[model samples]
Target: MGDRATLFPVKHVIALDVGGTGMKAALVRADGTLLHEDRRATGRERGPEAVVAGILDFADELRVLGERRFGEPALAAGVGVPGVIDEARGVAVFAANLGWRDVPLRALLSARLAGVPVALGHDVRTGGLAEGRIGAGQGTDRFLYLALGTGIAGAIGVGGRIDPGAHGSAGEIGHVVVRPGGPPCGCGQSGCLERLASASAVGQSWATACGDPSADAAACARAVEAGDPRARAVWAEAVAALADGLVTGITLLDPRMLIIGGGLAEAGDTLFTPLRAAVSERITFQHLPDIVPAALGDTAGCLGAGLLAWDLLSTEVSA
Candidate 1:
């Protein structure tokens, strides 16, 4: 007869960050180390149901991969998704980009994963949690995480928790009006902060100024570094608008730090140097929060998802 096999248990969790265009997933150990990672297209164009299927399939694949490598299945799963989320009910309430509406994602994932506990969260908020607990905001009691990608969004972290507010839409700083009669926004608001300061907005502004429709935000930054006056003007405008919005946030929340991430932040000092000066110029009474770039980059959301899964496991054990 064959020798008796040793039963060694491996502890790990599945974490997923589902965005409009793609999803990032990982098998994370209990100590926050990643065992494996992968990315998959969200296939949102095929519709919300299809996108849900894609997420589940990708998660299952990660679970199988983890089992194959570690000799055990994941203990739980956590998912971070864009748009408004009903975390209590584990539903993705609305995601305009993904065409999601009231989808019971957590329940579906739990069923798909054979009853593994699942936690669901808003993507930006989850990323903020990671930033606060392990990344740039580490040791800070309060901080604001602003993502300036295709559009602007924020996450408010306080005392190690992300405040989602009563409506689960606490940090929609992108909609805060900065220019009363400026460019229109998809949210039906004119002169919104996102319209003025988001990476897409900056790119459009530079493109229009330079008469090159294809110019992007990175190109604009390069042009500025190359001493292009038009690029400098465009970059300054965005910095001014961003500072205005950030000052407003500081006035209200009084966070200890403001962490900026997303595509616009790739400009590095080109964005931060002017942004600090602009914000300093505006502040009068409120304490100036340290404005810093996000340390985790694109990995924040995935790490935050891992945190959520681990938290859920803890909760289940305590219960």
Candidate 2:
């Protein structure tokens, strides 16, 4: 036995996305291979402190699980979360949904996880990176990966890198005010793209139109399938708002492809059908990028964070 440590691969990374309801974690190889995966409830209702503890526990569990299955400790951890992040500073400035403020999550995780290099990124931007590098945007230099779910956000990819901008708040397309005075958003803004085009908006708008407070987007879609005129109208508004946002993006970035992901993208043709039409209607002379659904679904963020960790490792090894 020359050197037992030399037998193992040079790098491994844990990708974790801490959400309000739960956390998604996966052990990934340098080449973006999935070595293992684990999920656990966020326990956020118990408060922010408890949520952090739960994440630490879950991460520890994964470290043990990955080591048992693959025979090595994780090299690094990439934690993705929603909020106003100062990526360069490795801090979560504010996360409204999580009630996180001025939280040095990277430092916290780093201290807890034994000085393993920890990278923290915005959840949506990280997903965008994954899409741009390995999934639908594998070959594209310029692309926009948009996530339309409970909220709306995007990843702006240029020259094969996701640019999170100076404030790490670059791709907040959802907060772009479309209507001067429309529905209120969780961000405390009115007429945001989120209020107009998000999955919640589609369902809520439909329910309100139909004079039923209980109906959600899924039920509204069902109503649409049953030919409910009001449901159709609500869905149309969402499609139109999304298209408007897309048009703005195209005008600014001129990306060659637009990747749509998240829960609403699951609608398949129901989304693409009218979305394409609306986008086409807005563009007069410019060429429209191919709008396609994201290939990796929700796992894009996990895979992307792993990719970032791999990148960090490679950079260090070569240096």
The TM-score leader among the candidates is 1
Q: Which residue runs of candidate 2 sit more than 4 Å off their true CA positions?
A: 1-11
**In model 1, what lDDT does residue 34 have?**
76
Across 151-263, the per-residue lDDT of candidate 1 in tens digits comes to: 89999998988999998999999999999988988889899999999999999999999999999999999999999999999998999999999999999999899999999
Which residue pairs of candidate 1 clash? Answer: none
Reference-based lDDT, residue 94, model 2:
86
TM-score to true structure, per model: 0.96, 0.93
Off by over 4 Å in 1: 1-8
Question: Hey, what RMSD does candidate 1 come out at?
Answer: 3.1
